[model samples]
Target: MRLRRDHLIDLRPLTTSPAFARMWVGSTLAGLGGQLTIVAIMLHMYDLTASTFAVAMIAVAGLVPMIVAGLYGGMLADAFDRRRVALVAASITFASTAVLMILTWSGGETVAWLYAIAVVNSAANSVVMAARQAIVPRLIPRELLPAASALGGITMGIMVSVGPAAAGLLVAFTGYGWTYTIDLVLMSALFLGLWSLPSIRPEGAVVRPGLRSLADGWRFIRGAKNTRLQFILDIVAMTFGQPTALFPAIGAVLLGGGAITTGLLTAAIAVGAFFSSLFSGPIARYPLHGRGIERAIIAYGISIALFGAVLLAATFGLLAPDRIGEDSANIGLIALAAVALAGSGAADNVSSIYRNTMVQAAVPDAIRGRLQGLFIVVVAGGPRLGALYAGTLATVTALWFPPLLGGFVIVGLVALLVRLAPAFRAYDAARPTP
Candidate 1:
């Protein structure tokens, strides 16, 4: 294969690895559909309960199960054929979503039923995510891991941006049934993606799936200082920094325009992620990845802080309703929110690119799947826990306080963590001695 320099980055996995490209296509489609159902379910529950706390609990309910599945699923990836493991996980995800859709379709949908099914879906998705992450490095070369990761971020942004906004429109226009059915159709594409990948099995001693395997993976993670520090830093950032749970309150109270504004703000973050990744050639050229992750997450903290500052401004009436995107959103505030979200997205994506590269390049292939499984767990579960935290805190206090305060916490915590662990800070991409 020929290498071409395009912009700041020189590698192009999309053109080189046909298998990776196919997987990306299939995953992207299914992800879009998944988002639609996720948004619809949250909205449906919110409408039924009229309680943001309840909406937050939907995430909370799924957290423990997801964590469990993620841990166990990593073992599965290490023990058996990864493709088969992924297919089984996907099957569970698909079946639960199908159940969710059918119940909503049958007109007997209850909040209790939605909660039950969402927990199942989220847990299964966690396993699929762990399996899929382990599968990606196998499909592409090491040199292109960052680009592949950036592309993954772009995929995430697009799926989240379009799906929820589309879900909102569909639910508002055609009811929840049609919106959910789209996910069912999209999910079928996932099977094709998994089926096409080469059969990937564990490289080293394949321990049977059990507590012993989980402990072995944890030990591996601990011994890898760079990997361990990065995980710790990321956890601190994600655990305290994520502001997604505040969207509903921001729409109704702080930002206005109800669900539409909420969707726009949510989509706005993805817009930032998508654009940032699009121009990621510069970021990919960075020599020091460990330092890059530290800085990017720090930048993310500032951006999220900006988001909170905007809300605080709105609360104090310093920023009027026009920008909030209500029946009368001040165009200036709308622009400001979008800017904040975009900046946050860019910083978060950069951090993700580096973190992903760190794990893929540093970890060995034998334990790689197991390690990646833990990575997936952190990636998927941290935000949900943050949601629970934000939601509970906001329920007790105020919406603006959560993000506003969370931002500062992320900034201080990440800086302290990075300073203490020089290994993560010293992670050089070119020398790459992870």
Candidate 2:
């Protein structure tokens, strides 16, 4: 009930553990660098081929491979030492990035080469991500799960906010080579972070990596009523409601603000996440874990609806531009949408705290990595799928239409799902049985 600032902080698992703290520091920088490289790659690919579709394919090309990497990486984590798995994955990334930098600097600008290396980079990053996520619980107490997740939110907030912006400026001023070089340097920290940790072997029996393993994970998930429901619910919310892919169009047309609006909108969500984590560390220590998740998701839906309202208001011209400083591209509408977005970010952070704790606490350590790999697949792949949904709807309907519909659908769907899953509703925090 009483939400302390550290309650917010402690909501994340990484904050309570010193070792995780160090790892977070490294991962945060590396995450930012990775984002920089990602945006840079998109831009570079576009510059070479001048096809947005081709640029989109870069992610598509890597999608299956990334999923494979995540799944197989989980297998490796479960079967072998987590530290070694992470190190090997990180090494793959580091080496791939170095090659990217070399290619960029050597005046080789083949679109094919870009696509090839991008696949390598994305696949490696995905595996490294799965391995790192599985490694989190080993560093902290069970009570610190929320705190660790909050720390992850902070890391995500900063990296996602800062990385793209920096990459844009760097690419605009200097070149893509510089961006790739920065990534190479930043990736070194991940190696150190992972390499320094002691070997973290799985706590329970290990399964071989394949179809059987996937089936076992599914069986394990089926028995986990709360876990299964949460994942399904999240898939619904993320698949239907995620409108990040439509940001550029929202800014350019529906919102009528442009790239600055797009960038600001994206960054505002991250800012909210940063503050949410800052406040959530202690909030994570609440009495009602399951109910907390439900309330948070409902709040998230409300926030999303508010975002839709802002978009609709902009489209309808109810809010005057000149009065709200429309001269510099009507930042008033942008600010209003930002508030909604920020609220969404906060609510989502809260939900993440519960969801992550549920996943880590409910599952055994031996299966945690593999399960987390699947979780990573969900986490990583959801946005790309969202991109498809948003892009398709935006092309046919309107840019703002998807968000407008998405918000309402999320509210209705999540509410209904939460109601259906009574066990999740009764999930207790102190004796987390989810």
Candidate 3:
């Protein structure tokens, strides 16, 4: 089991393309800031309303706008200079975040204000994400895509791991205004990154950004069976397996230790993602992306189920405290839950690496933006839907029930869908066919 030097994350992508390197660094920093705001908002919402459903609503509220932005942004990326498209989208994100910071400092922050700002931020970010992803294939050789994606996992790992933990500590000691201010400061790096990039217009036939472009992208997707199936697989895994909406409550009531526990729970997943990418050399060379995705997602589902089992055990008073509260925690149960979550994170990252590589290498550059737009939508939107599912289910049943049931559902549905899509199962990286 000893991993060799080459059996680790390849850093060639950074050296191969300076543009990609700068963008990666900037995006990583900005992503960290974004995570801070995301976790803080959730904690803030829970603090104000003390309702998990209210916290979940923050995501649900932004879903439609995000979807619209993603689709339109993709078209814009395909038709115009991608650098310009990304810059415009980044500006909107920066403005929305500034407003959020201002409201927090002015003591004018209300639930309604948070929701509205969140909606704006989410929509803007979807565009930024679509443009950014669409820009990736143009920056590096196709063979380097898997390595680039593994690098992205590292970026996400740092963002989630450091960001949430820092948010909790900052909110606990320094207050909400300072946390928002820090995020606003970090966001400036994104502008630098996007500003320095050279103009990149889409290759091949270009269609203007409009209804016709949308229909064109749709037509391409209809024929891209592998791409379509991967999207469906991702939706199934995320919708049923995500249990993030319950973190605040889980920390307060189930695991105890309040904001700190919530941060720890959130960070554990990213920790696993980080380590998985750290050792992803073999994964980058793997040719069977479709099968890799299937197997990885199945493992993800199992890990989620294990997490649910841990929560169920806590419910049964196994290694739990007689009296659990914000200050008092069942440390053992918390540890077990973190381990399960970490497993889920690692598995999910593996799945993401395969999925991303497939899309980037297989899809045509002319239409890449539009497909990536749909990709980003599914990635972002699925979690929102999962939050709704988790929040509602937890509200009706118990904190432990949602993940417990949802995990099995993810396993069953993903397996069934893959079985039905033989082409996906046979997908080969050497000759990618979308």
Report the number of the highest-lDDT candidate. 3
User: After superposition, which runs of candidate 2 have C-alpha atoms over 4 Å from their true positions?
Assistant: 1-8, 11-16, 42-61, 105-107, 110-118, 251-259, 316-328
In candidate 1, which residue ranges exceed 4 Å CA deviation?
1-11, 318-331
lDDT, candidate 3, 66-93, per-residue tens: 9999999999989999999999989988
lDDT tens digits, residue span 381-421, model 1: 78887788788888888777777787898899888888988
**Candidate order (lDDT):** 3, 1, 2
Candidate 2 residue lDDT tens string, 108-193: 76888888888888778777877788888788887777777878888878876677667767876788999999987887787777
Report how far off residue 18 is in candidate 1 (Å): 1.3
- How does each model score on TM-score? 0.94, 0.88, 0.98
**What is the overall TM-score of model 3 with all chains considered together?**
0.98
Worst ten in a row by lDDT for model 3: 1-10
lDDT of 2: 0.75
Q: Who wins the TM-score comparison?
A: 3
lDDT for 302 (candidate 1): 87
> 2 or 3: which has the higher TM-score?
3
* Model 2 vs. true fold: TM: 0.88
